[model samples]
Target chain A: MVLMFKIFKNGWLDIFAALKGYELAGVLGWQDIRQRYRRSSLGPFWLTISMGVLIGALGLVFGNLFASPMKEFLPFLTIGLILWTLITTAVNEGCTGFTAAEAMIKQISLPLFTHILRVLWRNLIIFAHNLVVFPLILLVFGVPLPATALLAIVGLVLLILNLSWMMLLLGVFCTRYRDVPQIITNLLQVCFYLTPIIWMPNLLPKRASILLLHANPFFHLIEIVRAPLLGTLPSALSWQVGIVLAIAGWVFTIIFYGRFRSRIAYWL
Target chain B: MTNILINNLCVEFPIYNSTTGRSLKNHLMQAVTGGLMGSNEQGHVVVKALHNICLDLKEGDRLGVLGHNGAGKSTLLRVISGVYAPIGGSIVVNGKVTSLIGLSLGMDSEATGIENIYLRGALLGFNRSWLSSKVKEIVDFAGIGDFIEMPLRTYSTGMQMRLAFSIATMQQPEILVMDEWLTVGDADFQEKAQQRLQEIISKTSILVIATHSPELVERVCNKMIRLERGALIAA
Candidate 1:
C-alpha cells in the first residue's frame, strides 16, 4: 500500500538523518551526562561509586539467598545488574525522547530521531561508566577472560539496535498520550521481575517455566550480552530471538512511524 | 533558489476530553472496549487551526503575516517552518530555514549562556566547525561578556534576548521565518542589534515575518496578508 511505502521511506530517512546528525546528538548526549553531575567534584565517577555499592549489596544479599558461592554469584550479579541498568534505563528514557525535548521539537524542525539517539547515546555513556565495575568484579571472582568474551560486542550492538527502534516507536507513542510513559514504566518494572534480572531461570522447578525465559524477548536480549561476557556462548535461540525482534519491531515501527510521524508535531 | 509552495493546506488540532486528554488508560480502554466501530469513540473535540489556504513564495519575497492573538499567526509560522504538518493538502519547501519565532526558541535556562549558543545552534542544524568559527562573533554581538559564563536563568531578560537574537541571526539562512519583531537590549545594544538584524535580513533570500505592526510591514515586506480566526482575510 501507499501508506506502507511512505512509512518505509520515512523510516529510512529518519534513521539516516539521525545518523547524519550524530555530531549534534553526540554533543547533546555528552552535555546531558555532564549536566547531571555539573556541581559534583567526582562527576560521572559518582555513577561508578553508586553502582559499586548497589552491586556489592545485591551480591551479598542475593548470594546468601540463592545459596550460590561468592565466586559464582558475584560476576553473574554484576553483569546482570549492569546490563539491566543499561537496557531498562534506555527503555524508560526513550519514552521521553520527544516529550522531554518539547521546546526543541515544537520550535525547530530537527529530525525527531536525533532525540532518541541522544537518549541512547547518553545511556550508553552511563553504561560505559558502569562497565568499569565489571572488570573489577571479574578480577575479584577470578572469572576467565576467554576469547568468547569479544562476542559480547555483537550482542551489545544488537541490543543497541533493538533499543533504537523501541525508542522511535515509544518516543512517538508516549508524546501523544502522556500517560503512556508511566504505563511503560510500570510495565518495565513488572517485566524486571518476570525477566530474571535478579534471579536465574534455572531455579524454576518446572520445565514449563523455562518457557517464560524462552519466550521473553528481554531475556534473550540480556542473555545475548550476559552469556558472552560470562565466558560462554549465548544460546543460538537468544540470537535468533533478538534478530527476529529487531526485524519485526522495525517493520512495525516503520509503518507506525510513517503514519504518525507528522502527527508528532501536533501532539507536542 | 529559496521557495515555499503550499496548496489547500488545512491543519486541525484534536482536543481530547479533559480527563482523557493525556491519559493512555482512557484511550486504550476506549479502543479495546469500544471495539473497532469508530475512531472517535474517545470523544475528541477538533479545533481547525488553519483552513484551506494556498500560497507561493520564492526568492526575494518578503511576506508579512498579520493577525491578532489566537488568529493563527504562530500556527502559520510553524506550518511554514515545518514544525507542524498540515492535515490536508501539501507543501513543498526548498531551502534551509531558520525559525526565530521565540526569543529563547531552543535554549535551556539551566545551561550557561555559552553552552546555550552551541545547543541552540546545533538545534538549528549548524555543524560544529562552523559554530566554532562563529562562537566569538556571536558572543561579542550578545554583549554579555562575563554573564555568558553563568546560567541563562541568571541573566536579565534583555540580556537573554540579546543572546538568543544573536545566535538565531548568526548565519545567513536561505529562508528566515520570524513571529515578531525582535527589539531587545538597552538603547546602545538596540542600535547594534538593529544593524546586525538588517545585515542578516539582507542576506536572506526569502523572509516571512508575522507581526501586528503595519509600519514594520510597510517598511520591510513587499507583500502582506491578514488572517482572522484561522482564515485568510483581505490585507
Candidate 2:
C-alpha cells in the first residue's frame, strides 16, 4: 500500500537516529553518573542496596498475607517490582525531558528526538543496575539458572523497545497537558494491584483474570518477560498480545513525534 | 562564501498579566497545578519584536546592530540563527554557523571547571577530539588557575565570564554572531576578550553582531545599522 510505504519511509530516519542518539545519550549518562558519584564513597552501589531494602520489606509482609510461601513469593515479587519501577519512573521522569533542559535545547540545534532517546537510555542504565538484585535472589533460593534466561533477555529487549515508544508518547502528552502524567501515575499505582505482579494470575476469578491478561498490554508485558526469568515458559497468548502491542506502540509513537516535532522548540 | 538571506521576518511575544485580570478559577487552577496553561481572558498583550525586514549579506560583510533593550536586537539574532522562526518570511543561510548568543548557555554550575569546558564545547557543536585538543589552550586562556578543577559555581563573576568568553572564541567558524557586548569580564580580562573577538571577526567571512555598545560598535564594524522599534534606520 502507498500509505504503508510512506509510513515506513518516514520512520526509517527515526530508527537510525534513535540508535545514534542513544550512543551519545549513553556518554551523557556516564558523564551524569560520574558527576553524581565522583565525590561520594558509596558510588553507584547505593542504588542496588536501596532497591533491596524496599523490595525485601514489601516481599516479606505481602508474602505472608497472600498465602504464597516465602521462598516462591520473593522472586516473583522482586522481578515484578523492579520492572514496574523502571516503567513508572521512566514515564514520570520523562515528562520534563525538554522543559528541564530548556537551557541546552534553546542554545543548540539538537535533534529533538534525541531527548526521548536520552530519557530511555538513562532509565535503562538504572534498570541494568537493579537487575543485579534479581540474580542474587535466585541464587539465594537455590534455583538453577536455565536456558530460559536467554529467552528472558529477548523478552527484555522487546519490553525495552515497547517501553521506549510508550514513554515517547507519554512524555510529549505529559509536557503539553501537565495534568496527564499525574493522572497516569495515579492510575498506574491503582493498576499495580489489579495486575498480577505481587499476586498470581491464577488466584484471580477466571474471567476477570483472563480479561486483564488479554486486554491490558501491561499484563502480557509482565508475563512474557517475567515468566521466562522464573524459568517457566508462559501462555502463548501473551506473545500474541506482545507482537500486536509492539506494532501499535511504534505506529502511535511515530504519529506523536511527527505532530509535535516543531512545537518542541517553542515550548521550552 | 557564506551568504545569509533574511526576508520579511516578524516575531511577537505574549505577556500574561495575572494581577490585573486574575479570576477565582484561574487562581484555584494555579494553586493546584503550580503552573498555568496561560490561555485567553487572564490577560495577554502582544509585543512585535521584529517587523517585516529584508536583508542580504554575502561573504566579507561585518554588520553591527545597535539598539536599545526590547528594540528587537537579540530577537533579530535569534531569528537568523533559527532559534526563533519568523511569523512571516523565509531565511536562507548557506554554510555552517556557530551561535554564541548567550555566551555561557549550557554550563552546569555543579560540574568541575574542566568538565564544564568539555560540556560547553560539545554544546557549541564541537566533537570530543576537537575539544580534547583545545583543552589546555582554553584553560590557559581562561586564566582561572587551579579553580578549573573545582565546581564552576564557585568561580567569581569575572572568572565565569572569562571561561564563557574563552570557550566561544576558541572555535573558528565561517560565521560568528555576537549578541550584546564582548566586554564581559573585568577591565584586565576584557582587553584579552575583545582581542579574541577581533581575531575571530577577521577570520570569518560574515560577522553579524547585535549589541548597543557604542564604543565597540564603532571600533569593529565596517557597516553599522541602528534600529528603532523594529525597523532598521539608514546606516
Candidate 3:
C-alpha cells in the first residue's frame, strides 16, 4: 500500500524520466550498434552472419558430440544463443548500471533509477536487432512459420516487464554489495548447462524434465518464449510456471528496488 | 522563506593504488615480501573531502564561497547540483536550481557547438521548441565565429567557455550555483561575462559563488561564508 502511494505520487515524474531515457537510449543504441560494425563491410549483417556461424558450429560440434540430429538441433541452438545474449547483456550491464551513470548521477539532480532504466532500454534495442536473426535461422532450417508467431511479440512484452524490475533490484543490490554481480555471473554460467537451452527438453526423462521446467526460471522464460519462435509453444502447465516466475521476478525486484531506490546514490 | 537547509556533509574520494597488481602471484609475494607499503596505506585511508558542514541560505541571498586547495568547493557545488549525495544530514531546497559549475564538461564533445547547447539544455529539463527558439539567442551570446557548427573538441578553451557560459545562463533559475573558475578567462569574454552576471545577480532569487577571491566574494555577494577543515568559519 505504501509502495502504491509512492508510485502514484511520483508516477508522472518517473514516466517522463523513463520516456526521456528511452529516447536517449535509442540514440546511444544507434551509436553503439553502428560503431561495432563501422569499418566492417557487412555492418549489421555481421550480427546475422556471426550468429549463423555460431549456431552452425555449436550444433555440429555439440550435436555430434551428444548424438543429436544437426537439422532440428540448429533451430534450438540458434534461438537459445539469441536469448542467452539478451539475458547476459541485461544482467551484466544492469550490475554496473550505477557505476556507469556515476557522472550523470553526480552532475544532475535527476533520479538514479533513470540510469538503470536507460541501460536496460538500450540492451532491449540491441535484443530487438539480434531477434531478427532468430526467424531467419528458423526459416532456413525448413521450420513452418505458424499463426502462433504472434506469441513472440507477447513474449517480448513479458520479457521487458519482468526484466525491468529485475534490473532495479539487481542494480541497487550490486551497488551496495559490489560482489553480487560476480556471484551472479558465476551462477549464470552454471545455469546454462542445467537449463537445457542447447539441448531439447524431451531428451531428459519425464521427472527431470518437469523438475527443470518448474524450478529454473530462465528455462521457463526461454522455453515458453522460444516455444512459439521455435514452432512449439509450451503446454498450458508450462505456461503457468513461466508466467508465475515472470510475475514473481517482478515482485521480488520491485520490493528490493523500492527499499533501496532512495538510497542508491549514497551507495554509489 | 525560500531557503536552503544543509546539515552535515561528508564526501570521500578514493584513489586506487595500482602499485600492487591484483594477480595471485602478487598476493603470494605480498604475503611473503609485501609488494609496496604506500599502496596498502593509500588503499585504506580515503581523503575526507568534506567533514561535517551545516548552513542555511535565505531568499535574495548572494553567498560568496572561499576555500583552499583540496577544499570541498567543487564537491559542495556537486552536492547541491544533486550529483554528490550528502553522506549525512538533510538538505531542503526550495524552487528550481540551475548549476553551471561544470557546464562545459557535460557538453557532448562529438556534437556541434550549437547542437551541444540544445543537448545540455535538454539535460537541464528544457523542452525542444523552447531550446529551438532560444538557440539563436544562445549562439549570439556565445560570440563564437562560424565554429558553432563545429565539434566542441575543436574549439579553444575560451571558445568552449563562451558556449558553456551561454548555455549555463540560458535558464535564469531561482537558484544559480557557480564555481569561482567562471572568472578565469580572456579579457574580452570577461568584460561581457561580468555584465551578464551583474544582470543575472539582480534578477536571480539566490546566487551561490565559490571563490577564494575576496573581490569576487565582496563585490558580488551580500553575505559570506568561510569554510575550513569542512566546518564553517565566521566571516
Candidate 4:
C-alpha cells in the first residue's frame, strides 16, 4: 500500500511535469496535423470540408426522415455532431496515446502525461477545423447569437477538462491491455447510437420514462454545450451531472493512475 | 557533481504467453471461466530482468558494462535514465543524462533529415531555437550534404547512422550513456567520428558504455563490470 501511495504521488507529479512541456506538446500536435496532410493542397482545411459535407448530408437525410423542419434540425444536429466528434475523436485517439508512441515512451524519460496532452491537443486542432462550419450553419438557419452563446465557451472548457481525464485514464488502460483499444473502439461505436446524436429525445411519447436520456452522461455533455450554442441554458440536471461526472472521472483516474503507473512500462 | 548510485535495484517483467499476454479478452475469459481452461496456460510468468544491482560512480568515471544478450545491461541504462522505475531498491542519479541507446528511435522516417534532427532533438529535451543553432554543426559533422533536405527514408542505413551519431554527440552531456561503440561512414569519416567522440568523452563528467569488446573497456573505460543472467559478476 505504501508503494501504491508513492506510485500515485509520482503519477500526479508527472502530470504537472508534463504540463510544463506544453510547448513541446503543442509543437508535436502541430507537427502531427501537418504530417497527416503533407503535400496535400487542401491541408487541414480538408477536415473542415469533409465535416461540412457530412453534416449537410446527414442534416438533409435525417431531417427528412424524422419529418423535422430544417431550421431546428440543422442546429440541433450540427451542435450535437460537433460535440460528438470532439468526444469520440478524443476517446478513440486516447486509446493509442501511449501504445502508438511506444518508441518515444521507452526511449525518452519525459512525463507520460505529455503524450496524453499531445493526443488531446491534436484532436483539439482537428475540432477547431471542424468548427469552421458552426457559425455558417447558424447563419444559414437564422439562429440568433443569443447572450447565452457565451456560455458555450464555458461548456467547451469543461469538455476539454473532461477529455484530459478521459485521455489519461483510457491511455493508461489501453496501453496495458493491448486488446483494450479494440474494445473501446467497439464500445464508442455502440455509444454513438445510444447517445442522442441523430435522434431527438423528445420524440418519445409524453410522460414516458426519460431514463434513457437522463442516465446518459454523453447526453448531458452534449446538452451543456449544445443548449448554450442554441441560445438557451442546459437543464440544471445536465450541468449537475456533467460536473459530477467530471470530478468523479478525475478522482477515479488519479487513484488508478497511481496504482498502475509503474506497471505501464513493464506492460509495454 | 555528476553521479549514479544504484542500490539493490530490481526489475521484473511478466512474460505473458501469446494467447494471454497481449490480450485482455483472454484474461477476461480466464477470469469468467474460473481458470478452468487457462489455469496452467495463463499462469503468470515473470522474468527477473535485473536482480539486486549495487553500483556507484562519480564524476569522471568511465564504466563499461559487459554482458551477453538479455543480460540486462540496456535495462540498467534504462533504469538510470528514469524510463523504468525500480520495483525494489533505489537508483539515484545526479546531473542531466543523455542516452543514445537507439540514436534514431524517435526519428520520423517520412520527415526530411532536417525535420528528423529537430524531432530527435525535441525527444532529447532540446527546444527549437537551441537545435537550430546546433543544426549547422551537426550537418557538417554528418557530411550527408544535400541529403539533409531529403526524407530520412531515402538515406542509406550508414547515412542514417551518421546523422543519428552526429546529432547524439553534438552536445556535451554531463552524463553520457551509450549502448555500443558506434562505427559508421567511410574510413575518413570514421576517423573524424572517433576524434570527436574522444573529445566529447574527455569533457563528459560521467560515461557508461555497454559493450562486448574488452578492447573498448581497456581503451576508453577506467572501470569495468560484467553481468550474467541479470546478476553483477565480480570483475
lDDT by residue for model 1 over A118-210, one digit each (tens)? 999999999999999989988877777768889999999999889889988999999888898899899988888888767766678787566
Q: Candidate 2: which stretches are off by over 4 Å?
A: A1-24, A34-38, B13-47, B184-188, B223-235
Stretches of model 4 off by over 4 angstroms after superposition: A1-7, A206-209, B18-43
Q: On residues A103-213, what C-alpha lDDT tens digit does candidate 3 reach at each position?
A: 767667775666666677677767767777777766776777767777977776776666666666678888778889999888888888888878877688888976676
> What's the lDDT of the predicted structure labeled candidate 1?
0.83
> Which candidate has the highest DockQ of all?
1
* A68 Cα displacement, candidate 2 (Å): 1.0
Q: What share of the true interface contacts does candidate 2 keep?
A: 0.30
The prediction achieving the highest TM-score against the true structure is: 1
Tens digits of per-residue lDDT for model 2, A1-268: 6765665555546556656645456556666666667768877667888889987888888887888887788888888888988877877767767676666666666666566677777778778888889988888888777678778877787788788778777776766566777798888888788788888776778888667767777888888888998888967887877777888888877765765654565544
Clashing pairs in 4: A8-A258
- Candidate 3: deviation at residue A212, Å? 3.2
DockQ of each: 0.53, 0.33, 0.27, 0.51
Could you give candidate 4's per-residue lDDT for residues A1-268 as a string of tens digits?
7876777687788888889878778878877987899879999999889888999999889899999888888888877887899899899899889887887778778888888899999999999988888888889877777789889888888778887898899999888777888888888888888887887776866554376688878888888888888877999998888788889988778778877777777778
Which residue pairs does candidate 1 place in steric collision? none
lDDT of 3 at A53: 79
- The better candidate by TM-score, 2 or 4, is 4
Q: Rate the local accuracy (lDDT) of all candidates.
A: 0.83, 0.74, 0.71, 0.84
Question: Each model's RMSD to truth, in Å?
Answer: 5.4, 5.3, 6.6, 5.4
* Candidate closer to the true structure by lDDT (higher is better), 1 or 3: 1
Task: Summarize candidate 2's per-residue lDDT along B41-92 as a digit string, tens digits.
Answer: 3255334566677778889888889877656777677666766656567788
Candidate 4 lDDT, tens digit per residue, B1-235?
7899999998877655544553654455444211112223336655667888999999989999998887888888888888899978999999999886788886777789999888878777888898999998899999989999998889998899999989988888999888898777889889999998889889999999999898999999999999876788865
How many clashes (backbone N, Cα, C below 3 Å) per candidate? Answer: 0, 0, 2, 1
